[model samples]
Target: MTDQSAAPDATPRPLDHLAAMGAPDALALVDRAGALSFTGLDRAVGALARALDGRGLAKGARVASWLAKTRLASLLPLACARAELVHVPINPLLKRGQVAHILQDSGASLLIAGAGRSGTLEAGDRPADCALLIEDEAGAASLAAQDGLPASAADPDALAAILYTSGSTGRPKGVMLSHANLWLGAVSVAHYLRLTADDRTLAVLPFSFDYGQNQLLSSWAAGACVYPLDYLTARDVIRAVDKHEITTLAGVPPLWVQLAEADWPEATAGRLRRITNSGGRLPVPLVHRLRQLFPAADLYSMYGLTEAFRSTYLDPALIDTHPDSIGGAIPFAEVMLVRPDGGLAATGEPGELVHAGPLVAQGYWQDAERTALRFRPAPVFSKYGGMAVWSGDTAVMDADGLLRFVGRDDEMIKTSGNRVSPTEVEEAAVATGAAAEAVAIGVPDDRLGEAILLVVRGDPAGEGALRDGLKRDLPNFMQPREIRWRADLPRNANGKVDRAGLKAELTS
Candidate 1:
């Protein structure tokens, strides 16, 4: 890991750095608003910042965006940063109640949304104290003629954005990120991904997610172009790759499973240089299939949490040898496996993953109880003394220094007086080639205390065949007691399978 304590000078700020990358007319983003150049992006952000300031929002006040992935939506964060305001991006897929919760919870001073989306909000949805600005009305030409926002004493340590969690378990809590947290994360990812000016990345993930938001930052940091896409199917992704000659793409495991099954044209397949995975582990069988499909493209298996933008990434070169490992720490991050006794775990022993470094976020926005539980002091032996994210994820470090994921501490299933990782069971089910996706949950059972419930989405005809395969592959206690087939599993806004939701539904 690079020196996290070292601070980078921020006189021009990150937004200006993108525009000053030599070619002002070079493309920065492509969307319905047309091809926006670096200079155009800089000016557009400035115009919006001025508009927000003119509308009477105090410096550091929260400005939330609840629109789709439009050009204006892409510019909101930069605009908020320039105005020294805290940006809160709400997932467009959220319902009325969820949107209301965020608006009231953040106590935002203003909200910028599309005309169509703005009409969807009821009186109860947004606070009476907060103002609303229609994005379609905030055009570049009109806003540019107005006065620009006055400079402020904004520093790197100031809070930049508040990203809300998926809230599968409870009400969504905002994850606070500082300007330094975002800036350093962008620099680290761009350096390690080897992003160059020639690279054209497709941004399909929601910007509300830290992983998705980094797509824009990392691409712009490298002077590369990003194409914003709200794709509906695997075909759309393939078409975008061919249309924009996209070199880099990032996706969750569920999306990858769908894309892997799509029929890729030779030209579309050749344009892709790299694909990164997170949100969940990529099954070994799917990894082999991706290699066969995209022989020229590099595959990066990564592991991360919202608290820390990213933690580890397995290098493309080691994909075959270490498919199960989450790799070592990424740039600017130090990942340690701490045992239950609050000490470092020995080699091959599973321990909680603790992330310590600059990338650790500022913690939850207003939930101190939750924040204190996840974000705590660094380990006793650490070189740093500040707070570290105590990620509840369990992992084991091998002799080669690569970290392999076990499962979440709370998600571990107890069966027959033994602890079982749902990931292990799910991996085995997917390897049988009888299911496209699998999730194993433990429900109440008097005999076993908790029994395995294997849920899958695949051809119904193959269920018996998969059961036979599982019988041979798994021991008695680890075997799932029942198998249920569904047309499709429910996915949250982040594209991850809604495990908590599924469990609640089963119990209810």
Candidate 2:
């Protein structure tokens, strides 16, 4: 990977970062609205920035967008970056209450949405200071046609976006990110993934999430064409890949599982050159199946948090030997496993994963307590002494300097004098080829203190066979006390398995 430590300081203007790459006629983005070249994208972003700036808002004011994945929504991020306004993207799946929480928390002065979405908000939901700007096709075209836009007015340290992530138990918290964070992240991921102008990326993830947003930034950094998609099913993704001849695709584990089970046309499967995954671990069984399904594509298993955008990504070359590992740090990141006492964790020891470097976010917006709990100072061994993100997720570093995700620090199952990772049990069940999806949770028990409860979604007739296999594969402590079969498991807006929702339902 290219050294990006000096990239943020060397290029303060994010718009200029894209300009220095290549010819202006290179393709940058593609959607139903058609393709946008680098020069066209720069001009459109500048025009929109001018329109937003002409609204007389103060510098660094917050601007929120709650719309579906569209060309306008895609360009708004770069527009806000050039205009020096903090962009807050709300997931289109969120309800009015959730949208209200984000607008209030971010102190957003302006809100943009489609007419249908804007009508969903109740009176008094938005802040009194906020103004509404409804985006219609005509309105967007007019805005993009404006000329004589002012130059970019942002510093590298200024807030670029506030991405609100769902908290375990409470309202979502907005993670603050700076221009340097977004710029360096785009450059770093593009460099490591080997993106080029010939590649075409299909973006299926929501722009509200950091991982989803990176799909656009990284592709643009390499002057590649990005197709923003709001797909409904695996078939939709398959059709898009076939139609566009897509070369690069990114997905979370749950989505990957759905795609692996679908019937793929041979041509579509071979069209994919690279596939990257995050949001959760790719189950070993799914990994093997994906390898067989997409023999020509390189599968990259990655791990990341919203606070740092991304931490580690396993090299595609090592997927055969280290199918379960999350690999080492990505570019411009210093990933160190730190124990609870603030010391380096020895090899094979489980500790909190801490990420330090330019990729670190600027902390949560307007939530000091939650920020303090997740973001902290760097350890004494670091080359630089700035703030670092203390990822609450637990992991272990092996002797080869590779990282393995154990489980969330808060979600570890403590039973019978032992700490067990739920992922370990869940992965073990899926590896037996009897279940499509599995979730393991600890429940109250009179004898074992806490017993393992396995929730699976697959054929009901196969439960007996799967249970028999689990008994032979797992120890007594790791075995599930009961196996519950369901038609399907719930998923959050970001498409992760809804473990939190399951626990809440059990209590209710």
What 10-residue stretch in candidate 1 is worst by lDDT?
A: 1-10
User: Against the hidden reference, what TM-scores do the models get?
Assistant: 0.79, 0.80
Task: Give lDDT per model, in order.
Answer: 0.80, 0.82
Clashing pairs in 2: none
Regions more than 4 Å wrong, model 1 = 1-22, 137-153, 167-169, 411-508
lDDT of 1 by residue, 277-388 (tens): 8776777888998888888899988888889878999989999998888898888888999988999999999999999988899989888988899999989966655899
Model 2 misplaced stretches (Cα beyond 4 Å) = 1-12, 19-22, 148-153, 411-508
- Compose the digit string of candidate 2's lDDT tens values, residues 1-508: 2233344233535543553353588777889889888787888787888888888888889999998899888988888877778899998876676688789989999999999988888998898999988889766755664773545656778888999875544556889999888888888788788787888999998898888999988888777888999998999999999998999999876578789989998889999999998876676888898999999999998888889878899999989889999999887889988898989999999988888988899998888998898889999977655898887888998898899998775665655423456876787689788899998887765344467888999988898788887775555667898889999999999998999789668646
Cα miss at 465, model 1 (Å)?
A: 35
In model 2, the number of clashes is 0
lDDT for model 1 comes to 0.80
Instruction: Give per-residue lDDT, candidate 2, residue 260.
Output: 91
